[model samples]
Target: MAEKASESSNSISLNTVDGKIFKVSPTIANQMQTIQSLIKAYDSSRVISLPHVNAFHLSKIIEYLEGKSATTVSAVKEFEAQFMKDLSLKQLKGLLIAVGYLKVNELLELMPKTVAKLIENKSVEFLRKFFGIVNDFTPSEEAKIREEIAWAFDGVDED
Candidate 1:
């Protein structure tokens, strides 16, 4: 029991691309596939470096991993709702990529689904802004594209 408690208390250091270091328990770190693989490959005492993940995304991913194992279904649902509500589209996209790379399946599924909900009933302009995608089409080309997908523009939110 003491060994189990100590194991739970044991922390691993994660080094992000922005030179930020975060210490998390082995339990939380194991949620990320990349980190799990690294832990297996190297000594747990070593600080794992994630060159592609930024601090913001890493922290959020850690937050999700730490929160996801709640005993109650309602608590997890509430936490997940707030977590999704708190992130902006840009943050969501960044997190999606980071989670995808980390292979955090729950977060990988959640972020994209949240993004899809945000995009649902939104305009082309809204999508372009949300995704940081450039609208390079000529007026006529855009018109044709819109015409082809007229249903997408219907029932869109004004905001």
Candidate 2:
């Protein structure tokens, strides 16, 4: 039937926020839950527009999907490590947002762990700087909180 033919199409087109279009196989598109839902709701033969995802992030997601496949488990671990390492802090944050928006389950699990590792054992000051969080507390308020939780700061890594 015509409906079955459309459903079994070779590739689906994705239109990014930056106006770039990417054609991806159903396997790849379905890996992104948001896109999978869109595919189910709309005609798979038409281009799916991602209003929140930019071209760079979309391309990175695609690259990650393709690279993770067709590799041994150990090789996939190495690939994931290298893939995360290659991204700058800005890119990592941006990609994490995109991954969250797309509901990519693998990345939803991986990225938060990676970010946690990045901040683990780091000082409050270092964390504030790393996340661009302003110190809103007055010096006295900060001193009071620190004094109250002095035990929490013991052996904390230096900034």
Residue 43 miss distance in model 2 (angstroms): 0.9
Q: Quantify all predictions' global Cα lDDT against the true fold.
A: 0.81, 0.85
Q: What is the TM-score of each candidate against the true structure?
A: 0.76, 0.80
Model 2 lDDT per residue over 1-159, tens place: 111123345688888898878888899889999999999999888898999899889888888888888678889888989889999988988898899999999888878888998878899988787777899999999999999999887777876
Could you give the C-alpha RMSD of every candidate to the true structure, in order shown?
4.5, 5.4
lDDT of 1 by residue, 1-159 (tens): 111223444688888899888888888889898889999999998888999899889888877777777547779888999999998777888887889898998887787788887778787788887777998999999899889988766677885
Off by over 4 Å in 1: 1-10, 134-142
Report the C-alpha displacement of residue 16, candidate 2, in angstroms.
Answer: 1.1
Q: Quote model 2's TM-score.
A: 0.80
> Model 2 off-target regions past 4 Å?
1-9, 125-144, 154-159
Best by TM-score: 2
TM-score computed on alpha carbons, candidate 1: 0.76
lDDT for position 108 in model 1: 75
